[model samples]
Target: MALDRFALPARLRQSRHASLLLFAATLVLLLVAAAWFTSARSDLAEAYSHVGSRQQALTAANQRQQEAKLRVQLADSARSLVERASAGGFAENEWGERLINISQTPLARDEVNHLLAGMTRDHARIFGADVFELSVTRADEGLFDTPGSKGPPLMLNLRGTLLFRTAQSGSGVAAPVAALAAAPAIAPEAP
Candidate 1:
């Protein structure tokens, strides 16, 4: 039931200054902590803003890529030179190949001209393919018709050409070109 403070230091008993100083120091430390927290929050917000900006930029880039692909597709299907030829146009004479060749690949004007030019050059010596005599007619012409009786006879008549030059028959170095074979008869249409 009794408590005793047998000893006391006189300096501590008389001085309240030390306690006040300790309280002030604690307050300053709390202020410093608050300031640091505020600055850290601002930095976090800035980092998030940068991430959003980069995402927006990436989205815009993807949109541009899609648009480019669409333009390429449109170019392929429309207003192309090949499409024009398919829709009833003739190869330019300056560009036309004089002689035709059996081409397995899709024929371009350059290829056609190559075949024709080659034949034309070869003919000057033996084949005798006079360009002036070679007729340039409309899509609706007889020479182009495939030889009948040569296949399933049909009326669609995909008209083509009947080159009447000194006919090609593996000529020049090896195969002999046609020897003015009698009045180039129309091959009999298949019955």
Candidate 2:
């Protein structure tokens, strides 16, 4: 029923200096709050930018790691292929026959195709030969379609000249060119 209890005190309500001081302190507090907000927003933006850059760097590092792993796998595959060829009774710089046996399993199809593609694309480089020739034929007369056949269905025949490079006269230069030849045969092994 009475609003007098909520009224300002008489001395403070009548003082202009007190009112001006309160207004100035309020303005200062507002300015300080504005400055703090600006600083906090900028800091938050910088943190976000830093996180984005770090994420990009991490993605790049992961890609590089994956590429390195792929390279290692490719190198290992090449090494194993070369070792198998070497074990097939062919010596370096000699004309000899190499045999590769392929299985006709679904699991081996990709490997077989990859091997054929490599042999066709880089026969000379892969075999370290100067001259190379390749031929493919069916190993059996539709035996794969038969119920009893267990052998592979394809064969590859290769011919080439093998060349072994040698360091010449302690100079790191290659030796003079020489004649070379090589041959490879592929067939299905008995199951």
Candidate 3:
């Protein structure tokens, strides 16, 4: 009995050892599977975050591209407006005649001064023409001292190259032709 208690049967001992080994192996495998699942979940979260950031960057880039395109269109429209204004020959001639008439009118000294200032500022807006080197002076001599007249008769002296649009060239593009406008020293007689 003492020997039996001290030593188990070989088969039973072996079976107990095997069962212990199997339980240890199963615990280790469960731990490994848990670790792998945690790592996979972490990797998946990082990938989702990276995708979100990339999507935001792409949206911002698209917005910037749209803004750049709008700016280009605005610049093209402004250039077209200027080109059209320069192309109209009759409009320029008519604007010149109107300026001549305004200058020939006898107005008060202050009024003439205001008109000259307004002409410089409003020429581009009203006539759609740019006038460089504009000079306004009294046309009639000793007219400032003349009685019953509001002020001296004025003359408009326009000097500088005018931007004229030439006919379509060989490239099918209308080129700007600069022509010097002759400035008359004396004012033309009123019709």
Candidate 4:
């Protein structure tokens, strides 16, 4: 069975311009589709980049919020500790002595010495305390020594330096510090 090659039209057989026109149209369509695809890909990439940056910014903000919260908590805890220390240090009826509230009163020499001795004895971490020097300047001519004084004694200035040593926690342990230092380092175990 032989197929007839001249079955269509005389115009198609005479020239190849129609076939060239068809090819050109197809090429143009392909180029247009390629350009559209490239533009769409670039837009998609830009959108993804924007979304990534937004996510990073959100993560950083959350971390900063957490840090701020932790700082506030720490400050509150420190304030509470200071309040407790102040209250326990100078209680109203401390040392079984019933006296007036002297938190704001200027302390006498004897009273200051008593307080220092009490602190040295009561502190858990302090091993020893020594007052190297105590200097006081009296503003009035005859304040405490005089029998008739209207107001309390006026002190111009008072200065003192306290030298204290902190007690080590594991000083009584069996292993000496020198021996521990001389010992070889142990390798960590594998997981």
lDDT of each: 0.44, 0.52, 0.52, 0.48
TM-score of each: 0.34, 0.43, 0.45, 0.38
Tens-digit lDDT track for model 1 on 32-128? 9999999989999999999999999999999999999999888887668655743432222212222322212333333334434433433322223
For candidate 2, give the lDDT of residue 172. 51
TM-score of 3: 0.45
Instruction: Enumerate clash totals for all models, in the order shown.
Output: 11, 4, 0, 0
Per-residue error for 46 in candidate 1, Å, reads: 2.7
RMSD of each: 16.9, 13.8, 10.9, 18.0
Candidate 3 total steric clashes: 0
Candidate 1 vs candidate 2, TM-score winner: 2
Error of 1 at 190 (Å): 51
Best by lDDT: 3
Task: Please identify model 2 stretches exceeding 4 Å from their true place.
Answer: 1-15, 91-191
Model 3 C-alpha lDDT per residue in residues 37-148, reported as the tens digit of each score: 9999999999999999999999999999999999999999988886785565323333323333222334445554554444343222232233333323544444345434
Cα lDDT tens digits for candidate 2, 18-92: 888889999999999999999999999999999999999999999999999999999999888877765663334
Q: Give me the displacement of residue 179 in model 4, in angstroms.
A: 41
Error of 4 at 14 (Å): 11
Clashes of 2: 4
